[model samples]
Target: MMNFHIHSTWSDGLYTPEIIVREAIKKKMEKIGFADHYQTTKVSSISKKYLKMYLEDIKALRKKYGEIEIYAGIEVDFSPRTNIDELPDFEDFDFVLFEYVQDSLWDGYPLWMLLDLRKRIKPPVILAHNDLSRNFGATDIEAFLRVLEADNIGIELNTNLNYTKLGEFYYRLATPIFERVEEYNIPISIGSDMHENLELLDDVEDALSFIQEMHLEKNLKLFLKEVGERYER
Candidate 1:
């Protein structure tokens, strides 16, 4: 199994990167990525000075545990107060995750703004735990898919319970969007959004089932291929 939304002590998570690596290896995970918080908020974001250390720590873990693939990533909070322009360049990381891009309650920046920001960042950018069904359900599906394709961005299937509403996962609620993804062959990412729980390191059984139901094998294979290529470099 593969997951790319894990958080460790570098941010607000309870565990450290070493512990996370140990847990993922114990679970027999094929690959995992560390995406600690990078919010502009002073209390929530990782300090700028720690950024280099964070990447180096994950890279070291990647080498030590050659048995499993490990990636360095960050989860950026895109809100009205957060300036995508002022954010640090992320070209060196394996991937980047954006959260609350269209949630009004959280003062999220719109998808259009994110599309513009996507052009500046170098690594793969994914929308994290978004309620897309609520945010983009009424918009033009084709247009949305076009922007995603043009920007080379991926949508995340978050397996975290906090994103569930009406007793269904957010991804399930966003059927129209994903249907278009299938039609357009856009890449998709899966993240358990693990914060404090290492026991559920790669526990994404439900997400796996959903991917099969949606016939997203080709998309997933493409994503994995890109990740492998990035690692090779």
Candidate 2:
């Protein structure tokens, strides 16, 4: 098994990077990626100092364990007004998990610009909760779907919290996006997005079952790829 997306003390998560990887090992997780939140919830958070410290922690864990492959990443919040370059450099991590703040997830991406952003972000890119959107107007989700379909970014189906309770950004909003994400050649990632240790295995089975029902195993090749690498040991 592989939990490509996880959290730890790297950010606001409950455990340290070492404990996170250890738990994954206990969960029989062959691969683990500690992608802490780098959100826009606060005007000033996840500072440069913190991010560097987080990355170093992951590296140290990797050195000590050297048993499981650990990917240090961030679940980045893409604010509509967010300047991509100003988002700081994430090239240090294996990839950046691109999610949006429900309030400001951009619904417009010019075809050319979308392609350019894709090119600029190497290593790997994930559009977290790509199908997930705010519950405002139907037009918002429609606009988002259009932009996502046109881009080659990967998508994440966060299973930690029930998005439905978070108002309109949950249930109804992501159904269509999930369908479309599967239709396109874009890949998908199922993440527990767990914040606590006991909550670690939060919704893997259900999330996997959902994807399986949709016959989306192939569409979620990234997780499999990560699993394969981890198990190569």
Candidate 3:
């Protein structure tokens, strides 16, 4: 299994990078990206300074740990786009992941603004999750999806989707967009987005099962082939 989006104690998560990578290696993950969240949206805050140590730690792990492939990345929101440049060499990382969750738990952002942000980001496996706005603003997500498709950004099929009333209904909500992406023959990556160590490997099967039941096997294979290559032993 491979997980490109993950968090550790460097951010709001519950473990250290070493522990996270250790567990990933134990679970036999082929490739994993430790993308801790960084601060964004401050009036004067120019960059995520906290990422310095995290990146260093991950890089050290990359050199020391030889069995698994570790990508040194930080998960930043699709806002505060100014900070992207503040980050050091993009070539150092295998890939990165981000989403459009600016408002409440809705997990979406303005498509036009997203398109604008895409122009600034250098290619590194750009991905967004389920399309739902927090303020309940009903916006057509096609605008952002189209731009992502055009720019060669791949969306993530996160298995940890919300399935309750309070939680945004991601699977059903994502059906149309997922179908649309498939119709366009765009690529996607599957992620556990594991916040904690255990949950890291917990939901891959469930997410795959949901998509399979929904009849997305071909899409799944295509997605795995693109993203899972790094995970192969």
Q: Write the per-residue lDDT of candidate 3 for residues 1-95, one digit (tens) a residue.
A: 77666777777667888888788888888777776665666222214564566667887888889998777655656554435445444434445
Give the 10-residue window scoring lowest on summed lDDT in candidate 2: 105-114
Q: Which 10-residue window of candidate 3 scores lowest in summed lDDT? A: 128-137
Query: How many backbone clashes can be found in candidate 2?
Result: 0
Residue 233 in candidate 2, Cα distance off native in Å: 15
Q: What is the lDDT of candidate 1?
A: 0.83
Question: Model 2, range 77-177, lDDT digits (tens) per residue?
Answer: 56543455556656677767866534443543333443566666544567665444442234555555555555655666666554445454342356655
TM-score of each: 0.95, 0.74, 0.71
lDDT of 1 at 42: 37
Which candidate tops lDDT? 1
Most TM-score-accurate candidate = 1
Candidate 1, 137-167: lDDT as tens digits: 8888898888787888888899998889978
Model 1: pairs clashing at backbone N, Cα or C within 3 Å: none
